[model samples]
Structure formats: C-alpha cells, structure tokens
Target: MEIAGTLRTAREMGLVACTSCTRVWPAGTERCGRCGHRLHTRAPLALQRVWAWWLVGVIAYVPANLYPMLSTRTLVASQEATIIGGAVDLARHGNWGIALVILTASVAIPLGKFLAIAMLALGVRHGSALTGSRRQQLYQVVEYIGRWSMIDVFVVAILASLVQLGAVASVSPGPASLFFALSVIFTMLSAQSFDSRLIWDAEREGRRA
Candidate 1:
C-alpha cells in the first residue's frame, strides 16, 4: 500500500503490500481503510526536487550567522549581539545554563542539522552506498531536532518584549532575526524534502539478485 507517495512491499508475495492492513491488494485500489493507507502506483517527484530545497537551506545558513540577531539600548547606549555574542553575554553574566542552551540550540544544532541534510542529499544525489543507514539515521536526527533551534528565536522575542522601556532600556530584533528564521525554516524544508524511501530503495537494490 502507498501513502504519501511511498510504496510498501509484501515479504511473502514479493508484491506491493497494503500500507494499512499489510495484506496484498491489487493495484489501482482507491482506498484501503483497514490499514488506513492509500495505494499509489507512481513515485513522487524524483530525488532532485528534494535536493533543491536542501541546497537553498545550506546557502541561507551562511548569512544567518554573519548578521547581528538582536539590538539592545539602555541609558541611550546601544549594542548589538550576533549569535555568538548572545552566548558570550550569557557566559559573562555567569548564566552558564542559559549560555549552554543558547550555544547548543543556536549554533551546534543548526550546523549539525544542515550538515546532516547536506550529507543525505549528497548521498542520494550521487547514489552513494557508503553507510546509507547512517545517513538515514542522521536525516531522522535532523528532522526530530529541527524544532529545538527555535529556542533562540523564542528567547529573543520574549526578551525584546519584556525589556521595553521608554528611555532607560529597550530591546529589538535585528536583521539576523529574518536570516535566522529563514535558516530554521529552510533547514526544516530541507529535512522534509528528503525521501527516506530512497535509503530503503538503495538497500533493497543492493540485496537484489
């Protein structure tokens, strides 16, 4: 059975299996509510369509770092903090816990997710058999952890709203907010664009006689 454009195969009959019930069903069935899956004969957009979004996310990640993410004003003095600066400020204030949180959520996680997606995209594009399962595992990790990267964004928004003062102090989001948001959004799109079925397909092809 097929759902979301993926095909499932039956072990015994060696034919496409119903995604919902695990029973063998003839092709072109409109619905299979038993297993709650759809049957589709054709594969979705080929691998390239998936890779394109990954490529865009990789490109956007660069600028997301170079720009300042937040601006602060206190006593008529203004300062801006890039992603690294925010982490440094937390460290300076002896807020090690928040510092580490910011570092992992903003820096390490985003980079890791991007690299993982890039590796997955590259492996699929070149049909690389080198540790396909590992690549797939990396893809799953990226997809699952993608939402955590929003922690920094939420922190920024919350602080900006809470620290507003007529003249004594204020906080505002900066250009990096847009870039950082785009970074998260595109990376998520990158993860979603990947086809996990390709990993299984490659594995099955390897075992085929």
Candidate 2:
C-alpha cells in the first residue's frame, strides 16, 4: 500500500488514498476501511494557482507593514500603532515575551513563509535541477508555519473584546490585520498549489532511456 500519483489530483478534488493498502477513499475519511492505514492526499493547486496567491500575499505584505495593526483609545484620545510600534511598546514595557511573539508571528514568520513560497514557486516554474530538493523542503516549511501567523489576529480579537472600557480605554483592530491575514492565507495557498510530482516528473525524465 504505497502512496501513488492516482491519489494526487484525485485527492485535490476531495479524494484520498490509504498509504498502507493503496485504497482510495473520500476526503473526509480518517482511515482506509480496507487496511486501516493513514491516508494521504494532495492539496488543491497545480503550480500556477499557488504562485498567483503567493504573489498576492507578497503584494499585500507591504501595506500590512505600513498600516497600523492595533489601535487604542482612552480618555478621549486615540492612538494607532503599526507593527513596529506594537513591538516597541511591548519592549519598552518589559513585556519581552509578548514582544517576541508579536514580532515573530506578525513580521518574521509571514515574511519568511512568503519568501520561501515564492522561491519554491519560482523553482518549480523553472524546473531547476540544482535545488529541487531544497525548494521542496522550503515548501513544506512554509506550509507548516503558515497558520501560526493567525496568532496576531487572535491577540487582536482578544484585546478588542476584553479592553472595551467605553470612554476610559478600548482596543481595536487596525486595517493591517486584514492585510496580514491575507498575506498568510495567500502564502498558504501558494504552498498548496505546488505539485511535488513536478520534481518526480523531472527525475523520471532524467532517468528515461
């Protein structure tokens, strides 16, 4: 029961296959009925689809950094803070842990995911023989870390809900939240769009007599 290409496009369309018995199953199934093996499925997207969304995320990233991500109001005064400002606030107040979390989740992780995705997309497009394996690893890492970018959004939501003190003090999500979310989503899509089969295809082509 080895995983095979039959499950790739099929799984992308909501089908899956058991890795132990090579049995096909619907996407919702947790295990193969015949062999009770874990299933594997390809994520939707071929290559172009992933690249398109990746590009969108990259484009959105600029505005995500430029615009404010959190706003505060207290005593009839309003203040908006960009990503850097938020980090600075945390650092200045000695909340180093929170500051690091915000920095990594909001700034470093998303950018790293985007750059890695873009590199994978470009590598796949060019069918570069020199670095295919490296690109694949990058793709996997981008996919795995993509969801963590939502931490900032979660924090914003929590603060917004808990800090509602009428005119005394309040916290609100800023425009950058939407952009940052879009950035994360697009990079995830980009990672999904990449087809690992492309590497295999090139390898096969190389081996053909």
| Candidate number achieving the greatest TM-score relative to the actual structure | 1
Tens-place lDDT digits, model 1, residues 145-166: 9988887888889988999986
All-Cα superposition RMSD per candidate: 5.0, 6.4
Residue-level lDDT for 202 in candidate 1: 63
lDDT of 2 by residue, 1-209 (tens): 87655533454557776656767788878778898875556434566687788789899988988999989999978999998799999899999998998898888898788767666656655656455566567667777889989888788889999999999999999999899888878877777767675655554455564
Clash count for each candidate, listed in order shown: 4, 1
Candidate 1 backbone overlaps, count? 4
**Candidate 1 clashing pairs?**
1-17, 1-19, 20-35, 21-35
TM-score to true structure, per model: 0.78, 0.73
- The models' CA-based lDDT, in order, is 0.74, 0.77
Instruction: Supply the global lDDT for candidate 1.
Output: 0.74
